[model samples]
Target: MMPLSIYFLAPSLDLACFLAKLYICCCIKYVVVLRSYSLCLFVFLLQPVEKLKKMDLSYSEHLIQIPNLCGAINLESINLQGCISLVQIPSCFKNLDKLELLDLSDCENLKDGMENLPLNIRELKLCRTAIEVLPSSVRFLLGLLDLDMSGCNKLKDGIENLPSNLKELRLCGTAIQVVPSSIGCLMGLSHLDLYNCEKLESLPKSIWTLKSLEWLDLSNCPNLIELEDCTSSSLRYLKISGCTGLRSIIALPPSLTCLDANNCTSLEEISSWWTPTVQDYDPQVQHQNNKSEGEIYNFEQCLKLGHDTCINVIEDGARRRILSALDVYLYLYLFLSLRKI
Candidate 1:
């Protein structure tokens, strides 16, 4: 047996054993590298972010206070949305020169102390706050773009003056009977939302002079009986839902693209012998991006007025439903359109 020594088989067995050992060594080295990498990642995650830029403590109802934010020199945005019990921000907040946005929406306990905010602030959202009166210093914020005070039920007529650079203003449910005439100073105002303003009776005559006015929402204003002529070249969307006191729609701007006058049972006529002015629209594609606006109204009373010429409510309703998709709007539009024929 030793003469030939089974040379071929013995050498093959030795080579196989060597290769198995090398494979095991490589796997062990790879596992060690993976463990080191995981340790480094864990350490990075545990590091503190004391130099934070944006601080969002939204929905922190239990959190009663915040530390001095002067240390955060680069802080630009602060959102305290729905912090119901929050009374006020730290007085040192004025040191935030870089702050550009602030939102205190739905903070019921916040009554005042926002008089002197950072001048660079471009947007302020104080919707549903307990603050009944706006600060006089609001006129100094020349960079302000939007101001939302919706659902502030106690705010009656405090908005006598506003930033001239304002582009959007929302005062829904404020219960103000008359709009401030100084609103016309905002030549840049494009969008205005006054939905569910039940106590609003009249509008400023200067409102019609806004050339940049594009969208106006006056839905559910039960006492609004009449609308003045709107000649804004950019005016497009308008809503007048639940205006039971209104009897007519006259002198509407030619730039109108959408109108909602639903449940206006007292509405008798539009434009006095009005015919639907055919507008250029995309019949194939719908405005799926728009919110749930443009509700359908029954214009049977307007038809019974026995005017010599009239606009077909079916054509208007079906077109609106096709665009906005209100609840049960599509079915009603189809039925009414067919019945009209």
Candidate 2:
């Protein structure tokens, strides 16, 4: 009853519609697969990209080694503080030429004989480490601005050359007996902390050249005998405590705001010659426990005795004891200030 042409056309129409729906479905599936692949690639790439921004693995219990760090070329800062088990920093650290800050504070077991660090590093902290004697190559860190080597007790020598751009340098709790005169070369230095350097006897006269210095801490330097002809127009804060042998502090700069000489026993008298408009003069002077008759000169009377006659005719033995006590108090104050920072 139906025409053959109609019948054939009906079958063709249905087949055409079915084929179009199948093609569309395949295209949608292909698109979905492609988008899923793109997302996976994005996630993989984003992981490393995110890591480049900041890396603070300090005290991370499981992070023992820094193996993956080699690929973090864009890393600018790395904080490894309190990483107790991290015994070694990868020598591949030189590969991170882009790194600007590196904090290895309290890495007690990290003693891999690292004498030289990368030159490009701007800030380096080696607090509470056992590395002794910074390599001569340390001068190559021309970009360094801040360096902390506090509590490195075995560090005895080899600090002749430091970077000229250095702004802050701390050598606290070290056994450094002598500081090289070359330290004066760092004209940009603003803060220098040499607290608890017990063996240091004399500072180079060249130290007077630090015109940009603002703060200087020479606390607990038991053997330090004198600070001769030192002048710093920019110096504002000075601490010279516990220096048992410190006989005199000469030519204080006019810009000083705080001068702490709390326990300098050997310091017979503050120089009356170079007067400055100081904001705070904490002469925390305390008389020795065992005072001798001649050494027990009244404080007000001693002030009028003129610089040359103060402490005159006092037995050398008694003078030594008083001087030692004064030095101890002075250094104690200095140590406290350094700790505050």
Candidate 3:
């Protein structure tokens, strides 16, 4: 074989001119590859910056990963949402102290949450990823506020000892049967959305003590049997729709403004907090006031309260009734006004 440099230096007009220069550059000391992997050859490096910030790589399907993001120590937000081919993150991700938001949602190839992350990370989203376990090191992220891990079907059990300062946590559509007891310590938690968690059977009793919680969504949790009576002073909205296994709902806190309990097929009991006088009332009042109560409680398709399918109504003088999502409100208001009789 002829020498490689002599073959390339045989200058044709367009092609040979570029190849000869590449050969000379390769011959020099420019390429500093440590362990040249025969499979793929690309040394991607970030341009040096005084203060790099905000990398929004959303919907980049082919981008596998970024190497050693710690090189840019001032990076604040790294949005890698819907990066389908991304398998793993760089090892030095934890060194970036200013990283506040890290969105890795819809990265299907990621198996587990990386072992270490920036301690100041405020918002971490892993929705629809293949994460099987949340690494124990997550406790050290003291500044974390929002953590959204919805649609991680592989996570049968998530992490414990989450940051106490966390505000919002969304764990919708996972296989987890129970939430970690350590989560009860998140006193500052404002929004806890567990939508469509079909396997969740119960919640930690300590959840009721979350004084700062505002919105709690447990919609479509068919296996959820009950909720601890909520005492949160800040709780405003609650959703328990499609929870067929729920046997009863305890008396709600005074602060609760909205409650959605639709499609609770097996709900056999309900708490009594309707009457201002705290006296028992009748369900017949629902039909009497149906015309005026449309805005408050519309019972367009409610199974008649006297029907055999009506299992049991709010635990009192009223007979049991298997009402759908809409009709629950009708009976509530009707019974409340019945106290006037």
Candidate 4:
């Protein structure tokens, strides 16, 4: 049997309300309102929608209200991305115990009801939103794994309370000044992206202790001055491009196979030792691979590095039986190296 669905047209208010009620009796499970020009939508019918599993209102440019969803107990996904006129998520969202994915990216005016989000969510994307701070209640989402808050220029704090089991976190282009020490609690995290965070000044030492962390991007963070020693970590790819204020790269993880430090105009020193100290080295550290069988280290335009410091990077790579590449201005020193960006 064919399932019934309703697409929002330029209907009268009464006609819209009547269709809202009519769909409820048809046991509809999916409600999609793509590019809806209506200023309002009543997908929830001001009542319970027990069988509704997904609601997609993406790119609904004129949408100004998020209909009440208190009784959508079975809803598993809701995509309201690009709803520029929407100001807030209704507090009743906390009642959706089964919801797993919520995409509210590009909601520029959103500012409230963050504390009322459902607990079972696994992936939440709030990219380019106007939220100032994540509410403390976010720590309660034990099942959440992926969170993207990139371009949240108004955000200043609250990342310390993120759930421990989260696997991927992206805070690109934010105004965050510091990464709290509590970040080490995300033991299972594998990907962390903080690219282009111009105001970021420092990262907690605990960031180097994340055993599962493999990919970390800190590109274009001009305010950062130094990268401290790395002790026990599994990071593989590290990017510090365009960090003009950086003065040194103290140390790195043994598992790291890629380092991109292009255009770091002020970098002066980089340690020869892979681990924090020679004594902290473990043979097993080299066994941790990020599905790659090669290495690439870029030092393009780093004219400040001393001759000896440059040699250390090459010698260390040779000792590890991997290729190495360094560029000081137009001169390129390549030893069986492959540049992978």
Candidate 5:
């Protein structure tokens, strides 16, 4: 059997001819071109790599382009992470319909030609890239489930064009100023990360309408002021630490079990119903049903929290504790009664 994996450690000018001879084998399944730091390597394969499944060119800092992979019909993953000199993707990249994962993290010079990504791609990582605006074509990637654009300082475009099928999105440390109203279209999104986005001033009312959303991080967004009229039915966790400009929180999701609002110095008004409602203890009902199970709350360093809000929070805690004690007493009493009978 012939070798199916190819490794190029120091590709020279003759490497193209070497690859041309190797391509005739037609069964190459993996290619790794690592750390070619001094050469502007441009690989243009002479024939189709019909069985190629994985391509890894990570840390090839001097690499500027990749081969046209139009005939790599079975290719599933491409790892271009840390290929900092790569300026654009090949136009033929859109033809790889079977491609599922593409990582472009730390490709600091990649700024354009992203308008035609594969339609069936599932996960795309563009963290710390030089992209200023996402191509409108991104919305058409209906099969995409995860997208990470974290640390993209130049990204300030409205995200209404994002694919609606995304389940997780990371836009942390970006310069975005507003989350557009069209964010409601991402009905399937479960995790949304916008941590440390300093220019962010507000969220659209539609954001609270995401029924599948479970985790939301808005930490360190100092320009954000208020959160009003929330009505989420599936949100489970929320973090808003270091938001010094936040002054009021009007409402939270009914299913929320964890909330972290630490260091929100300007926060004064917490919604009257910020804490889950305590219901009358019914011995027949399980103790877990008395209050939010496994609930966690953090209000540290919030010096401006209103007196009424503080009382409300304290009262809720006290009620839950009392209910817990009652449940234990009832269980013990029932045990004794059964023994006596």
Candidate 6:
């Protein structure tokens, strides 16, 4: 056989070129494979973005407008809280069939031009906005349970045709002078907050129909003078503080656990049938309308003084002792009279 070195030298350059081309081809194939793998991985990770069901864009200064969020068919909640620059909610929002919660609290620039929210929304907060009126389309929110519109200073018009299924409604800090009688239609309402509505003078007689109402706050409604016809049997908490014009409380329900009338100086009389457990009874203050010295009487003390005297009595340890003796005498007299009969 010929020597191995002699045969190897004859085809050395040809073999080198062939080997170089083969190595280059392998390097190109590896680069292609890596690029394809990276692209596939990226696509896999981004697939779930389409499945997003909840979004919160609060305090994001760059978010000046709401995009077409209707594509998110399964979206259940959207919170844009404190997005002060947001001026309006897109009209397409009505297309969100599954939306349940929509919070736009403190969106001060959101004006009255926006209209028609989705009917499926169960909770909504639009506090501290410029909204002046609610559109008639609001009646379409059949499933709404909680609606808060507090601090909408420009809101002077009354809400018409609210949903009957509403459970909690807050209209505090508005300029509304009257609440619509249509509010009586909300049979399921349990909590109503109308605090600081200074211009509100009277409540509709229909308010007596809220049989399911448990809490009612009418504090700081200075213009409110009469509640003779409005009474709710289910109300457990009632606050009428700062109602300086109110002179009487009539037809008070016995179910009340808390009654706050601390600053209502014009209240000259409390009915015999309605007596609340006393928490703080201060006697130094005088009545607002009359210069006569006023007194604070608790449930037990009121019974001893009788309805007429209770109005003049004040809270003092000495006065309480005297009232107790009077009560004993009255009871003894009643007992003797029954025996003689």
Q: Which candidate number would show the highest TM-score if scored against the true structure?
A: 4
User: Candidate 4: global Cα-lDDT?
Assistant: 0.76
Whole-model Cα lDDT per candidate? 0.63, 0.60, 0.62, 0.76, 0.77, 0.62
The order of the candidates by TM-score, greatest first, is 4, 5, 3, 1, 6, 2
Runs in model 6 lying further than 4 Å from the true structure: 1-49, 271-341
lDDT of 1 by residue, 1-341 (tens): 12211111111233234324533433211110000101111111111123455655565565456555555666677777877767775575677777788888988887777765776788889889887777677788888898998998888856876788999999998868888889888899999998888888888878878878878899888888888756433466777877777766655654455667767666766653212222322222234224335433334333323233235443444454453333343544554465567
> What 10-residue stretch in candidate 3 is worst by lDDT?
32-41
Model 4 reaches what TM-score against the true structure? 0.82
**TM-scores for every predicted model:** 0.67, 0.64, 0.69, 0.82, 0.79, 0.66
Cα lDDT tens digits for candidate 3, 134-202: 776777778999999899988775457567789999889988898877877998898999999999998
lDDT of 6 at 302: 20
Candidate that beats the other on TM-score, 4 or 5, i.e. the better one: 4
- Put the candidates in lDDT order, highest first: 5, 4, 1, 3, 6, 2
Cα lDDT for residue 119, model 3?
A: 82
Query: Positional deviation of 151 in candidate 5, in angstroms?
Result: 0.5
Clashing residue pairs in candidate 3 (N, C-alpha, C atoms within 3 angstroms):
262-325, 310-322, 312-320, 312-321, 313-320
lDDT assessment of candidate 1 = 0.63
Q: State model 6's lDDT.
A: 0.62
- Prediction 3 TM-score vs. true: 0.69
Instruction: State the weakest 10-residue window (summed lDDT) of model 6.
Output: 31-40
lDDT of 2 at 47: 16
Candidate 5's TM-score reads: 0.79
Across 1-341, the per-residue lDDT of candidate 5 in tens digits comes to 45756654353445445556666755554543322333435544435566667677687777777877787888898888898878887788899999999999999998787876989999999999988887789999999999999999999994878998999999999889999898899999999999999999999988888878878999999999999777444566789999999999987654555779999999998765633323323343324334455667788999999767865654554444444455454644543353354
Decoy 6 TM-score against native:
0.66
